[model samples]
Target: MFCASLADVFDNSVDLAWRADLWALVRDTPHLDWLVLTKRIGNVSAMLPADWGCGYGNVWLGISVVSQDEADRDIPKLLCLPAAVRWLSLEPLLGSVSLQSATGPFGETLDWAVVGGESGPHARPMKAEWVHDLRAQCGTLAIAFFFKQWGGHENGK
Candidate 1:
């Protein structure tokens, strides 16, 4: 399940009690694997539940990155957290990104990468080379790569 798809679970504006309630819901639903994607990677370490030691088994924590700068700044933070699965959402990929430099405790501990171009009315064009390079990097690193869609007025390659 995609947890908080329209809103960020780690956003500072979110009420503490509400976040607790959400954590309770997540704890109760052990059968479902929750994919929690957030752009606020820096806020996660402090906002996580008190009992989130080594992270929950059913939770897959992911960080969203649109370019190399964001990736470089956030991937390391995401890798530091102990999650059952650590992944990246490269949606609206605005520029080329090289993940080869992102090393963590267990080397590059990223388990998966969901890549795609920008979408919507004002979406910018995503170069085919950028996507291909990312895919190749993921292949070399043994990270699962998923190509979601090509952005901007068109679909597919």
Candidate 2:
């Protein structure tokens, strides 16, 4: 959790041997729970180690989503994979999103979701109503909701 927050381990841009060494580190670090959050989630299945029988016990797989389009396109793929836990990050929320269609074709839903606005001089603004709506939806669906922040240009707004 304390390591690279923005670097996706499944990224194919990196060297295979480097990825292997990283996975090896994750495998050997039995005391730490590794959270691999990525936007390149489509490459996840191919990036997994051969020994990932049913996925590692300490690893959590999550996808980054900025809007409904990404969520709709990625969540289904995420559900098909095996993992200790699955989640979504709505950080730097760019637009409103509805999770109603994000469920399984049957009725499955995600395990966790995080919501936060953008921050920085160049950051775009977000609506508080959007975050509230997401919280309500998570409540109704029993998905864990972690409200990270109400971002602004300065301070933790």
Count of backbone clashes, every candidate in sequence: 0, 0
Candidate achieving the largest TM-score: 1
Model 1, 41-150: lDDT tens digits are 99999999999999999999999999899998999999988889999999988889999656796764899999998888878888888889999999999899999999
Q: How does residue 107 of candidate 1 score in lDDT?
A: 67
Per-residue lDDT over 35-131 for candidate 2, one digit per residue giving the tens place of the 0 to 100 score: 7888988899999999987678888788889998998889898877777777889988888888876576545568899888787888877777788
Cα RMSD for predicted model 2: 2.4
Error of 1 at 126 (Å): 0.2
Off by over 4 Å in 2: 105-108, 153-157
Q: What's each prediction's TM-score?
A: 0.95, 0.89
Q: Which 10-residue window in model 2 sums to the lowest lDDT?
A: 148-157
Clashes of 2: 0
